[model samples]
Target: MTIVVVFIIVLIPAGMVFFFHHQNKLKLRARLMREAVRNHEFTFHLPVKGLFYGEKALQEALNDLGQDINKLVAQKEVESWQKLTRVLTHEIMNVSTPIQSISQAYLEHPKVVGTSLEKGVRAINDAAGNLVTFVDSYRKLTQLQEPVISTLRLKDFLEGIMELYHNITWEIGIPADTVLDTDGSLLRQVIVNIIKNAAEAGAKNIECTWRDSALRISNDGTPIPAEVRRDIFIPFYTTKSTGTGIGLALSRQIMTMLGGLLELSEKADAGYHATFILKFEQ
Candidate 1:
């Protein structure tokens, strides 16, 4: 009877210690989140492991809410870009259309035809036409069709991509059954752009995984220059002479439109140059 009494005393304190230790971790998450919010950071997430059922559920909800808020901010930013682009495009089209028309009219006039004026007018017409075409292409940034959300099995998606780009080696580390809810076509394009950018950066091996409900892609390539990191997602910004300057920008806008966020992660995996994260609002 004395042994039983002593055992209960020991077991109860040990259990209490474990319980309190676990509780501290949970409380730490809350404190971290509060600090993060106070600093205008909404992307913080905590692992839900070792939490009680109620705390786990609350943690999951908080994680989702943080991601959703981040997504909302990104979405609003892109929407503002779209509004500005729309206004600029409208004004550009208005001015360029008249310039093109007047140049064409001048070229057709007998006074200018078969003369130096004809050559100058033709150049003007061509330049104005090119401007119109350029603006028209940028309209895609604002005119994306509503995403037809579909469930894409991540395994199959990666398999198809590897087959298509068989020249480069791939290292995939994720559950085979992992899936994503997104527009398959749109998301595939964004992912393919990332792969292409990696290859362009001289990556011979690329790694992919899912973490914290975000698709994490890393590659063994030259690191991006620090000077241009912040401008990567800005429209009409690129380092390559022949680049359209909108690949990353368009990808980011697409993600925003699809209720997600695209970010270049600060932390890179070992043996990797950079990491890009595609985070879903969910």
Candidate 2:
């Protein structure tokens, strides 16, 4: 009886010590997570090492939460920029239309005709005309019509695009019977825009197929730079000197309007510099 009592006393104190240590560890992890989220570090990760099975589950959940937060933050940023673009484009259109008209009148005036002022007026006219045209391109981004969804035949759809671009070698691996319910016209526009951008980037080979429950188009050309990835969807952000930078942003907006997603795959397969994924609503 005496020996049993002694054993119980020692074991009880040891168990309590471990319990407190484990509790403190969990508390620390939670505190750190809150701090990370507060600082907008949504990519933070916590390892599930030396944890109780139940605690390991909690850790896994927390890790997934961080990834979810990161996605939500990205979506919000895109939405905020899209809203700002709409407002800015509206204002620009309102102002540039009058400027373009006034410049045209100045160029046609007899007093300015065939003189140095004509050259200057012509410059203003051209500038205003180009500005109006550029703003017109952005109108598609803000004024997207409601999608009329239809059953899209994958093979036929891609074949049409393939026939149009002969310079770039195309390898399409999607099954023949694979059908998608989407807005066919809008979807076509998005794919065409992406292909044109890739062609301009010097892509010699382009491949499109289905992967991970989505359509993935990958190209062997200039990879998107890391610096450009973050702002790739922002309106008017372009790498090319003549690029209006409306393609991807407009594509993303179209997909969003269609209850789908269009995104750049960060880690592309070997031999491919860039990959884009299109996931439709299920």
Candidate 3:
């Protein structure tokens, strides 16, 4: 009986020690996982204590944690974008309204129909037209609606877009059989904004091509400065004297909403190239 009692005592303590050690290991693993998430590494790890709770329960916990982190990051990004858009829209509209009203008034004045007044009216018209255009562009950036998707022939759609900028010289290289599923209006706007930027940059030769689900537009104009290129998609960031700087921003937002992406690259020669990748729906 004494031997049995001693054996029981030894076994009990050993079991307790093992239990605590296992728990300590689990705690350490959980800590490591949290650290990895904080560092933006999304690698998944099995919970050390998972065996106690069952694999399904442990997986659920990890999934919930991951979702929470993603939601926080996404919320922060959206908040920042909203703030920037609001500030830009407010500043642009302030300038646009006065210019439009004054221009209309000058043009409508009976006494100002002829003489130097006509010249003044014309000048005001030009300024107001530019302001109106800027305001329109800014609105596009700040107020994006959910895209309406449809299947479209890539060649036909691109050809139509090219027609709008027919005055500008262009060289297009795209497969005639390429087809894409996307929002037609939004895609057109993206094309127009990029083409307009190329024209404004004094592009004498604009080249467009499509491959690997991406459409690339290259313009042989002055290269975009590295510093400016970084912030090109930012709302109200512009290099032009008359630019409202919302065109590229709007285009980026549209593409993002459509589950696509827009990127800018520089050529070794001269000028900039903009690429838009349309992700295929799974």
Candidate 4:
């Protein structure tokens, strides 16, 4: 009876310890998993044998989700590019077809060496030349050079850029020692386009800020209307009388090529009506 009593006492304490240890192991594994997914380490490796059944099941689900997300993103990008090409083709043919017909008619016309028609034909030729130049500029969208990336100090870059727009007031909120890995020249072009548009829209104040590797540029200009917002990112889409419609589109393409994103945010702060955000990959 004494031996049985002793064994019971020993087994109870050992069982409690075992229970607590197993619980803690599960807790630790769950914590690590949450951290990995939050940090975007979706490809993190885990031993198949050491984990409990639940952990193994979770790992398999995550792997499947990651693959599905990648496939969807790739498919969407291809569709977007295809739509952009169709718009470009339409724009090109519209100009080229008329130019070809007009020039050919001028050549075949029996209106001898010089007359009033000669002046009209010369004007048409000059206009066609200008349209060709415009199309050539648009082609640069597809020909963007790969970025030469480097670590850049944000405050200094903004301060220098601020020098270019002396007429507009600046409200800079970038944190000190904030740095980013990006292509300086290419990023500058993107910023320039945004800032230029803000100034053109009659914005008296522009705010530049950053958080969590995302840069925000807010302006005191009128907010873009809801209907126009959806089409703003489409290549060759614009509302301004003189707008080429390529600036924002080119900026977005550059950001995509750098594995980042450029987008317009609907939210606004007091006194500012429009905002453009650029998010970078970690």
Q: Which numbered prediction scores highest in TM-score against the true structure?
A: 1
Q: Pick the candidate with the highest lDDT.
A: 1
Candidate 1 Cα outliers beyond 4 Å, as residue runs: 1-69
Q: How does model 2 fare in lDDT?
A: 0.84
Encode model 3's per-residue lDDT on 1-282: one tens digit a residue.
999999999999999998998779767767877886876634343544435667458766886576455435434444477677678768877887787788788778888887687887778778878776766666665577788989898878877887877677777677778788898998888888888887887767777777545677777666777667658877778888977777877777776677655656433323444433333333
Give the backbone clash total of model 2.
Answer: 0
Q: Give per-model CA RMSD.
A: 4.6, 5.5, 10.5, 9.3
- Give a tens-digit lDDT track for model 2, residues 1-282: 999999999999999999999999989998998998887666566889989899899899989787666656656766876688778888987888888899889888898888889888788878878988887888777788889988888878998989989999998989999899888889988999989989988999999998645788999888888877867888888989988888888888887777767778767766799999887655
Q: Is candidate 1 or candidate 2 better by lDDT?
A: 1
Of models 3 and 4, which has the larger TM-score? 4
User: What is the C-alpha local distance difference test score of each model?
Assistant: 0.85, 0.84, 0.70, 0.77
* Ranking of all predicted structures according to TM-score, beginning with the best and ending with the worst: 1, 2, 4, 3
Off by over 4 Å in 4: 1-79, 82-113
**Model 2 spans with C-alpha error above 4 angstroms:** 1-75
Q: Count the backbone clashes (under 3 Å) in each candidate.
A: 0, 0, 0, 0
Q: In candidate 4, residue 173 scores what lDDT? A: 95
Pairs in steric clash, model 4:
none
lDDT measured at residue 25 in model 4 versus the true structure, 0 to 100: 80
Worst 10 residues of 1 by lDDT: 39-48
